[model samples]
Target: MSGGENSSRLIDVVLDESIGRSTPDVEHERAVAIFDLIEENAFHPVGDEGGGPYRLNLSLADSRLVLKVTREDGGDVVTHILSLTPFRRIVKDYFLICESYYQAIRSATPSQIEAIDMGRRGLHNEGSQTLMDRLSGKIEVDFDTARRLFTLVCVLHWRG
Candidate 1:
């Protein structure tokens, strides 16, 4: 397909309901910043096996992001951005998604990480399930990948 066709195809993927969760205009801006943060954070490749030249393509709306994981031979894995909730939530969700996908790719996957300590434990309860648990059946996310992501989370700061 041509660029125009691909562009149209991308446009068809609706943003996840997370964007609608933003309560205020300021929250909306924070969501955008979180998206940018995720985009920037995504530049680094994850896991040794499926080494990417991971490429990110932002969708039609600023609400979602598409990360295309590429191989040395030019093969690729296309991941659609499903959600971008308000404030700190998006940051949590994005990294969890990436880390979980990364971990799912591993030969040995960790069980799950849950949120405790009033969300201060740094564990992100993005959805009802851990990104690993959800993506585990779909992909393979191992320790190193998860660790890298956890580390990424430590460094990810939302700018107002």
Candidate 2:
């Protein structure tokens, strides 16, 4: 990719293990989201002219989501702490729908699985939008990047 492309993307993402551990399924989701995020994303901290492919460390503290951004060389950029209140409902619903979808994969018909999957994706999208809105003026990210970040957020929230 070009220099500009590299400057606005994430090169690495780390989830704070102290927050919690994930189940196998959740682990898979976290891994995939991180992979996808690093592969391509638009992440530019507002007013940051560091021109860097950033590193992100996600963690939860006191029911709040903490986003720590740093330059590729580990220089501090910015950290955003956001309330989890707005995402509680959507994350809960998304978890329910995801469970249904996973269960459906074992026995339900393709149509049924597709329907559940649709709801799961819808919730995911809603959560992504909420994240983008919450990060407004703090961090700028495209919709797809927001989606992946939302997935990571959900992973951090997962207790099992």
Which residue runs does candidate 2 get wrong by more than 4 Å?
Answer: none
Score residue 31 of candidate 1 by CA lDDT: 47
* Most accurate candidate by TM-score: 2
Alpha-carbon local distance difference test for all models: 0.38, 0.88
Residue pairs in collision within model 2: none
Per-residue lDDT for 9 in model 2?
A: 84
Off by over 4 Å in 1: 1-61, 86-129, 150-157
Provide the lDDT at 152 for model 1: 29
Top lDDT model: 2
TM-score of predicted structure 1: 0.33
Could you give candidate 1's per-residue lDDT for residues 1-160 as a string of tens digits? 3332222111111223432333464455444544443333323333334444333332324643234444434455545343333324646555556455555556333443232222333444333234334334333434444333333232323222
